[model samples]
Target: MSSSVPPSIPRQPAAGSKKQSAETATGVTKRVAPGGKHALTETEKRGYALGVELGSDVARQQMEVDPKFLMQGMADGFSGATLLMTVEDINGILAEIQ
Candidate 1:
């Protein structure tokens, strides 16, 4: 019988990968109206995102946020890590954009 493994997954290891031995980083994409007037006007805001494989040892709620959403207009992303701000600043992320 064939191993029931996903074909898209790679089984090799990188010499200098930062992730754990069993975990791999997954990328996802999402597209959502930045939280602004439009976001309030439009009930449904779509978000595109990538997946980060946390590994089999733990349980994770899988979700994707588009890379574009990580831009300056959205959240303050730096050095690959997304930043969080106070409710005031966060709520106005896309305020100027739209």
Candidate 2:
């Protein structure tokens, strides 16, 4: 009896590498918008500023309360409203918070 096994094929270059090379050769690039990822409109900027200002006021209100309250408040605020925001944007904001 004769065995019947097909020859294996060699692997090609990675698709990602090919894409990167193509992009480089074509002078194609990507970058954050002037403001950042998910650039906020003027209205969004006003909302963010108001939210921060209100948070500051609330922080003072919690001077005698547990610190956890403030943390929970921040978590709630971030979770509740995040229009026109991306993970990168949120991370950058959190980094500034720290």
- Could you give the C-alpha RMSD of every candidate to the true structure, in order shown? 19.5, 21.5
What do the candidate models score in CA lDDT, each in turn?
0.35, 0.49
Q: Which runs in model 2 stand beyond 4 Å of their true positions? A: 1-35, 63-98
lDDT per residue for candidate 2 within 51-85, as digits (tens), equals 55554554544544344444454555567643346
Model 2: residue 31 alpha-carbon error in angstroms: 22
What is candidate 1's lDDT per residue for 7-59, written digit by digit as tens? 34354434643332332233223222233323322324223212232221122
The TM-scores of all predictions, comma-separated, are 0.19, 0.28
Candidate 2: minimum summed lDDT over ten consecutive residues — where? 17-26
TM-score of 2: 0.28
Using TM-score, give the best candidate's number: 2
Judging by lDDT against the true structure, name the best candidate: 2
